[model samples]
Target: MAHYARRRCRSACAGKEVSLMKKVHVIGGGLAGPEAALQAAAAGCEVTLYEMRPHRSTEAHQTSDFAELVCSNSLKSESENTAPWLLKQEMRRAGSFLLKEADATAVPAGHALAVDRVEFSRRVAEAIAANPRITVVREEVISLDESGDHITVLATGPLTSPALAAELQRLTGSDQLAFYDSIAPIVDASSIDMEKVYFAARWDKGTADYINCPFTKEEYDTFLDALLTSEKVELKEWEKGQYFEACLPIDELARRGRDTLRFGPMKPAGLTNPKTGRWPYACVQLRQENLRADSYNLVGFQNHIKYGDQAKVLRLIPGLENAKFLRYGQIHRNTYINSPAVLNGTLQLKAHPSIVIAGQLSGVEGYTESIAGGLLGGRFAALLARGEEPVAPPRQSAHGSLLHYITHAEAKHFQPANITFDLLVPLEEELRKKIRDKKERHRLQCERALEAWGAWLAQSALPVG
Candidate 1:
């Protein structure tokens, strides 16, 4: 299908230079769109990147900045020999623009790669704005042009606006492609009762970057009681049970059991209470919000509780007493398509090869995965615009594994996923038998994936890192 489109584009643009004949239109300036724009420009395509902010705002977005990290600043585990680390390694090999900026604005978050959200977005926006081959448009793209005049990359992350979503549904005849995602609250550093909190990383793994708020059994029980009864923001009928498993709300965890939060987000398994000289019964870890380190967000505290009641409940955490909230936790709808049904291996809409689907909208989850999707969409669209065939990343690589799952998973039961060792193609029986330790197996898989990715990058029509 993509071949036919490539042939048509080649004939239509016949003698004209490929770069001059086409422009790539990337919609949504979230984590994915800017990457797509920058990547397409890097591939010698003229690009128009659209962002609907500072003009029309969404429920969770607070600024006009591009590539904002809305829910969590942390981009999952960065420990070597891990799935998330493999995915990032692949993007770095491909010269991902967003990942480069993320590294520049990184903050100390122990083993995970967390960044100063404000600085990260600012750097990305500056890069997009300064690119000579790209133009930025500050408006929502409610409708798309599929006439093959140009290539379009839809990368509007999880919080894709309603109108555009409806238009997308109209174009593709898709339904039941949304879920409710919650945001965690940020507290002013000055307001925290730090005497009750101490800095420590779990197990002393990487430096003491996290602020640990220790809680006694009595305090945890009291907090649980308040949390279980907190009035939550109501969701529409369709959004009732659609929360993604990895990002469920704090209150929802409370409903599972009396000890769920203690074992889950509030686990104190490895953290020691310095003053008491032992781990507390429970804990709430707060992560720095920005490079300035003036505020911290409650780790794993995404919630849908009503603001008035929510504040009271969250303050029950030991050190959060008298906490002043800079932002309150809330829920918003996250939109995504059934990629297995609608998109091809290269992230192109099957019905419209000129359009590339990406980000959460393309059914992958997490911040890092979204940027990786953008890299694929941008490269595919750029190659297609230049009347060349878009090559799929080798299935052994992390990038290819994600695209493969999204484009080939069982459509009816598919859900957006984050990178995991399980998602990467499993090892052959011989290798699995040889590597008895699971960590060793994972490390080997990540190594092979990088080698495959490196070989693929070497053969690309354009140069990559």
Candidate 2:
């Protein structure tokens, strides 16, 4: 999920920014909506944040709090050389409110920004409640009209309610609203066979935060055979979009090769079974999905297989034979308009400038990426409301790469994306420096990004005190 952080600095701007006292409506109170609300409120816009909970609920959320995380608790890595770490650093420099809160409540997880889910959600709810400029409405919005006098931002997230989804379809003049995003299963920690699974992080990097279930040559072959032959859930008529590679189900991975599992999610890198003192032939690593540490999710194991087949076939792993599933893998239709065809870099829909779409609903994936999208989009919407010039981060920046990817990616093949160095513009020719080390090269890229981003922020003339 998306998160924010803040750096304290003395105020530098000396002019009064335009005030948008007029009310702005932000639909959905997940990561994106709240970020949008916070940004707009900070810009002097009176934001009405709508969240459908308590009275109405989604399948994934168990609480009424805003910005709930339905999956893993860790926010990936915090190493500056990593792409995610650079992204977080960029967000903090951009004055991201959500990141500020996340950093404030972060828990130790080696180099990851893990948090107590209960405390995180509660803090988010309290922050929004305390913002006098934001009015939290616990009502589900069925639909929105583009003809309205005020702007509306739809950050409804992946599990958008059916009624509002239908309304969105009507507004877009297309039958594109979708439901059913299948998540991978989480396993009960007590059930895993500790003797068979080893604790290690990839490349001996970071901390021993993962439990890896290894497979030998013979066992991997059998598992592949079972995965390929296992029955899969039939797709519905409207649920026909091709699965994104990052989230490809195990069955699909199996079809790629007899040895694909060994190379893909089950790769036996940076791990050695204590018994043999050697890396296993293949492996499946389970990461903590909650702060309680009572459960772990099968990393890279999202699937659309029949639930029964999942239990029967997945248990073939050496450590998962008696696994008790906290959640089952299943596939559902996800819907999004061709963002390149519908939205600008600022996330404004092309045909209607007053409307913006954020989060997974806009074809961006992962939690933090979605939050970054909202935070940036919110700033743009605030600029639009105040009639100020819109700002875009330099292409060298992570935020700019994401904005460019969603707005300029080939519409026909558009898929959800996570912020990565590959998506950013190539480094300067003069600065190539003939570096061969990947980590050192990444450090150079990040250094360039920070300098460019600082220049961009300092040059942008925002009307703020």
Candidate 3:
């Protein structure tokens, strides 16, 4: 069996003739690394996937499972209306293995692609394990020789091992690896004062799902004061202070202004409190955290507050007066590279052309975005393995915009991003000025992106089969 496997690998390496067996080593068995390995394997290259799980664990992940959705189980929207939705569509068309598993394991989440986290990871792991050309190795890779010619994809993700992280720092010559992301707390459903809370999804367009804790003007002011004054978890000495804007802690929001949250995530424009028969001054909305409906997470309430402070201050909210915390919000480290400064459009490090960085490591945010990066990195790496030069997605597509941002955006102001219309190539000047409705405009952008992405895929010489 060993001899046959070796022979097969050798045959794949150079069409059964070359002496040297060409193989791709993918470090990190998370979304990007496994995907990269699978792609390379599919393209007739032997792939050895190194995963540091079970033996070594990161701050975010608790399981030995590969491609674990540590933070969120939702893969965002599956509709074509959202940029992430469009990106998923593009990835599907491009034969993304991850997307196939996600589809198979998908749970009902309205329009979003939510999944049983365990099942999702298990499915992904099984796929990687079953792939004949891919070998899964359980070990930590603490170093990489960026000067070498071999292609190495670093998908170590946000919770990268410390030693490898240091090695990455040495290679990049930048202090950009991050180590702190905050999660929102979930409250026990039975504990909340439902009399003061109302069930309503935003815009009343979806199911009457979210439990909103209504706040009057005085209540909101007091809440803001408490939030601002609440004790916070301090950063570690060695860890850099960086919070992705989308998940900024409430304390950081408080620093902006008393009304910062009111205008930002706490904005309650559409729903009216059922008990009061009016929209509250501002609302703290909670969504069912699990399918069991026992706990509900505070939407837009990601925080770094001390556990005691979290309990005390969260209780101050109108409906949460007697709330029992199911999970206390905690902060963990998130690592990433300064993509704009170090990476090209393909997420390959400029100084180390053979190494490609994907996922949050490339400065993109959200689960889907991370998977998308992995998808692209895998395809790019496979093409390179085939001796075909890597190709960038068209600038008009979401993937293209992300790559463009990582490679070309101003390094001084580089920020991790989720897909947004602003990232897309601008619509024609005539269309931009003429479009009045934002949703309609976004739809137009999506349409154009699909068209452009299709054409680009057709033109690319990479073997789609």
- Reference-based lDDT, each prediction: 0.88, 0.76, 0.77
Q: What's the true lDDT of residue 164 in model 3?
A: 89
Best by TM-score: 1
- Superior candidate under lDDT, 1 versus 3: 1
Q: RMSD of model 3, in Å?
A: 4.5
RMSD of each: 2.6, 6.1, 4.5
Candidate 2, residues 238-309, lDDT tens digits: the string is 566467667667788788877777778788976777778889999888877655778777877877788888
Residue clash pairs of candidate 3: 178-334, 178-335, 179-333, 179-334, 180-333, 180-334
How well is each residue in 61-170 modelled by candidate 1, as lDDT tens digits? 88888988889898877788889989998999899999999889888898889999998988898898799999998888889888878999999888778888887887
lDDT of 3: 0.77
Tens digits of per-residue lDDT, candidate 3, 1-465, equal 121122223465556654333467788877777777777777777788888888988766668888886665677776556888888888887778888888887654455676666677888888887999988889989989664345677898888888988888888898865646766677898898888787886666546767888888999888888888888887677656666777877788889888888887688788777676777788887766555666777866778888898888889888899899977777677878888888877777878777888888888887788888887887777666555568899999889987888788888877778887778887788997999888898898888888888888888755453
**For candidate 2, which ten residues in a row score worst on lDDT?**
1-10
TM-score of each: 0.95, 0.87, 0.87
The TM-score that candidate 3 achieves is: 0.87
lDDT of 1: 0.88
Better of 2 and 3 by lDDT: 3
Query: Which lDDT value does model 3 have at 16?
Result: 69
